[model samples]
Target: MTDTTSVFENSPEAEFGDYVALLKPRVMSLVVFTALTGLLVAPVSVHPLVGFAAILFIALGGGASGALNMWWDADIDRIMRRTRNRPIPAGKVSEGEALGFGLALSGISVVMLGLAANWFAGAFLAFTIFFYVVVYTMWLKRSTPQNIVIGGAAGAFPPMIGWAVATGGISVESVLMFMLIFMWTPPHFWALALFMKSDYAEADVPMLTVTHGRKATRTHILVYTLLLAPFALALAATSIGGPVYLAASLVLNAMFIAGALRIRRRDEAAAEADGYRVEKRFFGFSLSYLFLHFVALLAEAGLAQFGWGGW
Candidate 1:
């Protein structure tokens, strides 16, 4: 048998914060927000305590996925300037500890969600964890230029899981929410890749910018931004949609497309000369773009209580 001593060797003593870093808190926040939006916008109502518990469990599950991703990607993380300080990469947590923490949380979160909500929602969460850890992190991230394109589905599932928490099933509204994130992910990550310099290339991750060239990646960002518009607009016609969402969708999509157009038109010389200002600005706007769209959905949901919301 192979000697496994190094695999389980203890690293430096880890702090509470280091362990938390293993959870990728920023990504978990997005998961929580989108999931909460899905639950709130659903036609069915959940008791406050149950809704709270469901969201908590869902957030835990998302964190579990993040931990597992960190465990698996520890090597890549060490090589990338953007990720070198992560728990495992920084020697603050052992791979074994991260793997164990992730697995324990995964089990607890799935079981608690099932008890708090419905079994279907629990199963969906389980599948999401599996997809992110096994499918996206393990399989796609290193192998293909289309990793973010296909792997984006794993991130897109949170809102649907949230919708299921209330309705205990799927619907057009939940699906549109899923599509909105799914379509937006490629352009969002691609823009980051555009400005990230050689992180992906040095790490040997097959990002579009690494394998296909920046020009192709720029074209892709434009294409995805254009494709994303329809889904965002279509959600405005759903039961959960209203004037607020429609107006937000129109303006955000217009601005997003304009950003993508500017990105596509720029060559490397121009981008490098300006320090990738356009790409960086586009990336920052993409975060606000998603957040504002969801906030508009929440606003519409609130307005519906006063009979001023949906069409």
Candidate 2:
């Protein structure tokens, strides 16, 4: 069938699942988890119901951003294998509907967050949605290889927003949470780019792998991995970290660095011929890497509650 044919069949009303797909549920889950970590670890406290509301709004904002992103990137997404089946690209949702849904949800999330939590949290949520949709998807993705590196700021805002919901503002502690995700985005995305080089090349996108070649991408991975280590440790040094964080950081960082080093050692042909097992393994591990770090932070928060451990 033609692309137009596919697009029409994929509208939100066409299938129950298409609507959920538009929200980018996987991304929302990560946002919820990280934001919860931020709320739980913050020095201040929020009522249980209010905390739940804040996280709910944050999740809604994240979904809004994803819908907007899907609306904007529908054309290229249709062409790329990795995103070809997304609700918009597959014809389950029209661009206009996605845009309207996203705009409405964005406003609702921000206003509701303000009423349920604090204005600071609400403002931060608005900014995150704007940055992700306008800054990252519209402006950055196709403009430069540094897109994920810099645009990562959009994704990194969740935990900070969560912290603000509790603490009513930013702090060194909250900023450290932001830094961990910011540093993590590059290697995480670049690994996917390495294996999906052909998808980028087909779309004429300037991913680091496409622009600089896989060899250079591998080198870049190692460099970013090196940079990631210090930031991870620095988070441990902040008020967020404790014995649990220290131990988690040490092991996760060691495995992450070792994965990058392995990628650096493999030639492009070797890496690809093995179906990018190394890159894929690293990508898989990176997911665990982020989750473990946040869980470690949660552990630290629990420990501090008992006066047993804290930064």
Candidate 3:
């Protein structure tokens, strides 16, 4: 007989490292970098210490969202090969402890950001956390295959929030940054979904592949990739982008689009037989695509400081 009684009693007590793992630190790195880019590119200048504080608080908010997500998704995560080993699902942390930790950090991050930066940035950070945890994790995740598509907006908010920290307001540039990430999310995530469809199927999650089949998912990836190219290029037309950003966008999008096309051309059997190697490569390249784009934007900003590039 399965021992179903008082599992918590035997479960290891949650530790500091487990709590940290709940935060998904690697994902938080991208959040910090993109937010810093937005802050740097904004026309307004902030004190270095204040800018640092704002980015730190934004990162904490990202971590809070990640923890909350892990807490909520622990069930499906345990069933899925990709997420089976996360802290909560793998028995490293109790769900209750994760929930409490996430909630506390969410509150602390918002209040600290307001005190250290501005209320506008703080409020946006708060909303970002709420949207990710409540709107995305609680509402959208289990309900629809469009989960990542809509949930991506939460991830897209960091750069805008950082821009708000510097300018104390929103603008086209910040919105463009948000749009870039927003458009990038579908293709990026769908590629992984293509390669790992079995995991989602086993977890009973309504990922695109689970709800719509690999062929349909591949088509959707291609469609989103096509849509994303313009946004990637459009960023280069913004005040933030210049020679550096344009060059990066051109090269990255060319490769990304080509990869998507290749995926579209491959039959499911061929893809699976090869362990979806192309999809995996595309997924890895997509990570570089985003980071390189942001780095290019930063380089342009740096160049403009020396009167080298800008509108």
Candidate 4:
């Protein structure tokens, strides 16, 4: 359970923007994009209005997860430089307000998603919220070095939920989409951990970098990036894949592997001398790596309309 004691004095009032910030809109945007991609790439077609509502509810669920996370982590958020300004830690919103807001959004998002799409997708979204807030945030984050490895599942679920919204069930394609994010996550976050340096350590978050050492983390990034390649390329052989996706995956995977290798070979002295330029570049490229792969998937979906996409 989260320590409910106030970490900061409550602000007089939380503005509308403060409320939005509590939602972690930047993270929510990624959720919306990936979930939207899942919906678009699925074999089934949904009414635009229905699809729109489903995506909205899913985004709400993601936001709810963020709120609850902030509420729970308020104590540590106050300590972490990267997170010190979050609504809860900064005193813009009270913990009670964040909790109540999160609960409200969670309920609404789940119930409305069930109504707008299928009950399966709704239940999945509910489970996702639970996994993120309870399982990941409350359980794994502070306890284990593998937190991000497992917690990554919470972020990975959006695309699957989007696929479920359209198909009313799961499939190889959806699972592949899920795996793509799941595999991509460790390296992506480990890179951030690499650059963020002491933030996680000061917070006592037990991130892989802190627990296993930077060398191990770098090696893990390379191994995961290598493992990610097979899954990415395999997706190109699926019904959703096409020439565009295959071409994109090939180039992206090559570059991603190269980036990982660069990180793996560098020592702390070299990194410090260069101000961690290589790691920072790797982190920035990681964002494009995932985005371009998804965009390639979307491109394949679009091309299919013209009879040029898919196996």
Task: Report the lDDT tens digits of candidate 1 across residue range 8-121.
Answer: 464377999998888889999999999999999999999999999999999999999999999999999999999999999899999999999999999999999999999999
Off by over 4 Å in 2: 1-12
lDDT over C-alpha atoms for residue 91 of model 2: 73
User: Which pairs of residues have clashing backbones in candidate 3?
Assistant: none
TM-score of 1: 0.96
Reference-based lDDT, residue 293, model 1: 92
| Candidate 3 residue lDDT tens string, 1-311 | 24655665676786778888899999999899999999998888999999999999999999998999998988898888878889988888889988898999999999999999899999999899989989998999889999999999999999999999999999878988999899899989999888777787887778998888889989998999999999889988888888788988999999999999999999899997999999999999999999898889888888888999776
Q: Across residues 47-82, which tens digit of lDDT does each residue of candidate 4 receive?
A: 999999999999999999999999999999999999
Q: Which should have the higher TM-score, number 1 or number 3?
A: 1
Q: Write the per-residue lDDT of candidate 2 for residues 1-311, one digit (tens) a residue.
A: 69978876653554667877888999999999999999999989889999999999999999999999999999899899999999887777889989998999999999999999999899999999989998989998999999989899998999999999999999998888898999999999999988877899898778998888889888999999999888888888888887789889999999999999999999977975888999999999999999999999999999888897675
* Cα-lDDT of candidate 1: 0.95
Error of 4 at 148 (Å): 0.6
Q: What is the TM-score of each candidate against the true structure?
A: 0.96, 0.95, 0.94, 0.96
TM-score of 3: 0.94
**What CA RMSD would candidate 1 show?**
3.9
* TM-score head-to-head 2 vs 4, winner: 4
